[model samples]
Target: MRSALIAGTLLLAIIATIFFDEVRSLECYVCSRQEGNAEKCLTTTKTCESDENACQSEIRWGSTPYWSQGAEKQYYVTKKCAKKEDCEEYVNRFTSSCQRIWYEDWKCGECCQGDRCNYYIIMGAGNLKATWLLSLVTAVVIFRHIFAS
Candidate 1:
C-alpha cells in the first residue's frame, strides 16, 4: 500500500513537470518608442507568452522632416520577445535594404535565441535549473522507494 502511494506521488510529480513546461515563460525587455539620449535603453522585464521564444531588437533611422530646420537625424529603437514564426517573417521582410518613404529612412531588425540575448546578457544557468530540479525530484523518489520498501 505504501509503495503504491509513493508511485502515485512520483507519477504526479512527473505529470506536474510536463504541465509546467507548457506554461513556461521567458523574460524579455518589453518597450517601444522610448525616447532618450543614452545609447543603452532603460528596460523593464516581461513574462513572454508561450509562443514567443526569441528576443528581438530594432533600430530605425529617418531623415529630418522638411518642417524641421535642424540638421539632426531621427532614430528609434525597440526590444521585445517575439514568436519564432514572426521572427522569421520579420527577417525575410527586412533582410533586404531598409524600406524608405518620403520622410522615413531605413530600419534594421535583429532576433536572437535564448533569454535576454537582445540585451547582450548571455547566461545558460537558467536552463540548468530545470535539470537540477528534475534530478532532485528523481533522487527524492528513489530514496523514498528504497526506504519504503
Candidate 2:
C-alpha cells in the first residue's frame, strides 16, 4: 500500500507539471485600447492563435497644434499575440493611419515570448497633459469669477 501511494504521488506531480506548462504556453491579452480612470488598463486573457507565439504591446501618440486649446494629444494602445517576425518588424518601425496627424508624438512597441506579458502599458505624458489642461481651465474660471464679482 505504501509503495502504491508513492507511485501515485509521483504520477500526479508529473501530470501537474505538464498541465501547467500547457496552460502557460499560449495565453495572451487582446485589446485595442485601455479604459477607465485606473493607472493601468485591465486586460482579459485569451489563448493565442496557432501561428502566433509572441505577445506584443504598442502605443501611439499624436499631436495637433491647430487650436487655442494648445497642442491636442491622442493616444492609442494595443496588446495582442502576433508572429515573431511581425513583432520584430513592429518594434523597428510604425505606420500611421492618419495623414493629418503628421507628428506621431510618441510610439512604443514591445515583444515578449512569455505568456500574458503584454498586459500592462502606461504612457504618462498624455495623462499629465490632460490633467494639466483641466487644472489650467479650472484656475482660469475661478479667477474670472473672482475678478467679475
- Please tell me which predicted candidate would have the highest lDDT against the true structure: 1
What is residue 126's positional error in candidate 2, in angstroms?
25
Local distance difference test values of all predictions, in order: 0.63, 0.59
Q: How close is candidate 1 to the true structure, as a TM-score?
A: 0.54
lDDT of 2 by residue, 87-125 (tens): 879877753432334454666776766556565553221
TM-scores, each model vs. reference: 0.54, 0.51
Candidate 2: stretches off by over 4 Å: 1-25, 35-41, 64-71, 95-104, 122-149
Distance from true position, residue 77, model 1, in Å?
A: 0.4
Compared with the true structure, the alpha-carbon lDDT of candidate 2 equals 0.59
lDDT of 2 at 12: 58
